[model samples]
Target: MIDYTKWDEYYDGGFADEEPINNFNEEYDERSELEKLEYGGQKTNVTAKQIMQETGTTAISEKFLYRNGVVIILLDYSKGIFDKWKNGRILHCLGDRTYTTQQNTNGLSIIDRTLFNADSIDKIIVRAFWKDETKKYRLVNGLLVLSKEKPYTIEENGKYRWVFPLSLMSKYNFQMPEKYSYFLDIKSVKEAALINADKEDGVRLTTLNKLARFSSSKNDIHYKRTPQKKIKYTSVQEKIERSSKIAENALILADFKCEINNDHFTFIRKNQNVPYTEAHHLVPLAYSDLFNYSLDVEENIISLCSTCHNQIHYGKDSESLIKKLYANRKELLKEAGIVLSEQELLEMYNNS
Candidate 1:
């Protein structure tokens, strides 16, 4: 077992000079030589269940589902997580059954005990299973954030079963896929790359897209650029623009809704035979030069109706509007490795 307490040390400079303790057999391992990954951090083959069990969290019912390495915890108690949802945040506990320190053998809450000993279990998966139906979700920062004005719910047991808000899911594209394994595991950037490029894993597109973006953002890659014999400086500035493919995909994913206000396009374009909402890049394309990663991906783009769209770029209170939109997209942008703070983004616009 890995001593996760020292994860930060290993994650930094400590493991750079060391070799992996275990080796995969050549014939049995199907991965090519290049695909064989070397980690500059501690690794263990331990499963998520084993990790959870070690922390004194066990399966209360078979409803606890594990798929592809992701564990889905179902909160069925009367005063479950639903009670903790407040002020746009859910106070998520580590274990299903809440107990006092005296009741628990470890003399600490499940989260306290686990986090005291280990780093953390990066993502938390939750879902609903009732009346022969299931609904799924992965927490946004392991907590649900409600919209300020809209109190949305699909009441179950006279309360909301869908603890995570639908607007959030739509904004972040967290809709549960029709067919998904209880477990989700993507170990390396290569795996993430493969998943992102794959087209046939039913409901894989959105889920894998998110996973891939998160994975790619965290991993290091060797960037190669072709050599240019000479460089020229031009007085004319190139137009900072989003890729047509990315814009088109963003519009399609949004289903023509104005993400900023949750309003629909008032009119349909005759030629396209579809509602028309312009794609607005959350991190504006004009600032493209400041970022290393592509700023033209779907995650960075939002669909808006003509009114909201025009107001965003021109209204006197556009800064406030931009800040509001930034709040909606901050998490998504962070997942994709864009880190421009609200103030920094505002400054760019103000200076311009």
Candidate 2:
């Protein structure tokens, strides 16, 4: 019979370790030790199979951080499970925390606007972890969807996460499994204010409209509806907000005057120094698909007062207004390589 202790020592030193080290030129022990320290003493250093065998648990709690700020809620799920779910649709949210990563139910004031700007969309890499399991990562472009529910009245109360409603999930081609029914309903103060003043009258409309522009999302379109039985409407496309550069440039180009009738705004915005005017994409940004070039450029942007802008889209003679504007910009648009005729542009707007 072979001597077992001498055989074990020979196997460990010569065969078990030497073969892989010589073949791959890898320093597994050193790399693992470094990763162990980098991941904050987490158990990701162990293999997933080993972890599963030891703990008898398949699911893990994952936290996502962005620029060192917490942006994901603590959710329990396996990597394979989340990957399968994400195949349908991936959603993310900004967590209720200060920049210091401490929980703050009050608001997102402590959040860094530099990295997590509330006004614009940001692409973030989500780092997810499950108890002692190897950490999983995903890169997704996500936006903040404000909760419709009141924070104070809710049982948990105060700060909460953004939710993907079933309606929206279907729109995005994602379906939540029957077993998981959790949805977020938390909103920030700014979002709440905008929702509350959705249908403002007169002076309030100016502020509402201004706030609406600042708070609009480039990826999604939202609309308010009044109950009616006669009309059946289907949502076709998401609204894309004009770039800040395009809007501001248009305003400056028009010298703050209404492009249609050359009239100044009726009322000045409450805290703003400039007269209020809405930015209108001449070719309608919604139909941007038809053109090879971007519709969000300065030449395609026009400034109009609230009344004129609304009339162009909803009034009985909106077609005539669109034609007139097209006529005015045809040459300039031609110069910028946007060669759509007046009727072609009008049809594009109507279709959208």
Best by TM-score: 1
TM-score of each: 0.34, 0.33
- The positional error of residue 187 in candidate 2, measured at the CA in angstroms, is 38
Query: Candidate 1: lDDT of 208?
Result: 24
Highest lDDT model number: 1
Model 2 clash pairs are: none
Clash count per candidate:
5, 0
lDDT of 2 by residue, 1-352 (tens): 2222232232122223322222111322222322111111101223333333433433222233334323332233443232111111222333333232223233443232222332222332122222213243111112222212212211134433322210001011111221221111112124334333232213233433554333223333211111112222243111122255446556666766788888645566565556778777786544433445555566777878888888976787888878888888877775565555454666555543
**Model 2: residues with Cα > 4 Å off, grouped in runs:** 1-242
Mind giving the per-residue lDDT tens digits that candidate 1 earns over 270-331?
45556766667676544554555666567777878878877866678788778887888777
Model 2 — TM-score against the truth?
A: 0.33
